[model samples]
Target: MKSLLSSRPVLWFLFLFNLAVAVVAPFVVDGAQGVMTAVGMGVVSLGAGISLARDRGRRVSA
Candidate 1:
């Protein structure tokens, strides 16, 4: 469980899940709810991207 949490697979899953939500949300929902979904997805994606970048930078620096 610890290894799984620390690895790239979890990050990939989060990224894909957020992307899928971003893509499908507008189709399934309407109006304000859909917009909020999109905004939340964007925030999640941005956080994942920043985490990936920081991890890569750490590896490179070390």
Candidate 2:
């Protein structure tokens, strides 16, 4: 579980997915939908970053 969360590929995927959503949101959706999508993407990215950091810390401790 810790190893999986700390994986660089997983972090990169989260980043890229967020980037893709940000790029497409403007073209496909407007106003509230765009804002909601943006917020959701941000939350996911932040969660990924936090998880990665936490896993790395756990690995270092162990």
Write one digit per residue (lDDT tens) for candidate 2, span 1-62: 86775588978788678867866776688899898887888778778778768868988999
Per-candidate clashes come to 0, 0
Candidate 1 lDDT over 1-62, as tens digits, reads 85775467787777778978988888899998998998899788767777777888999999
Instruction: Write down the RMSD of all candidates, one decimal each.
Output: 2.1, 3.4
Error of 1 at 31 (Å): 0.7
Query: Which runs in model 1 stand beyond 4 Å of their true positions?
Result: 1-6
lDDT for model 1, please: 0.81
All candidates' TM-scores?
A: 0.77, 0.62
Model 2 TM-score on a 0 to 1 scale: 0.62
Question: Which candidate number maximizes lDDT?
Answer: 1
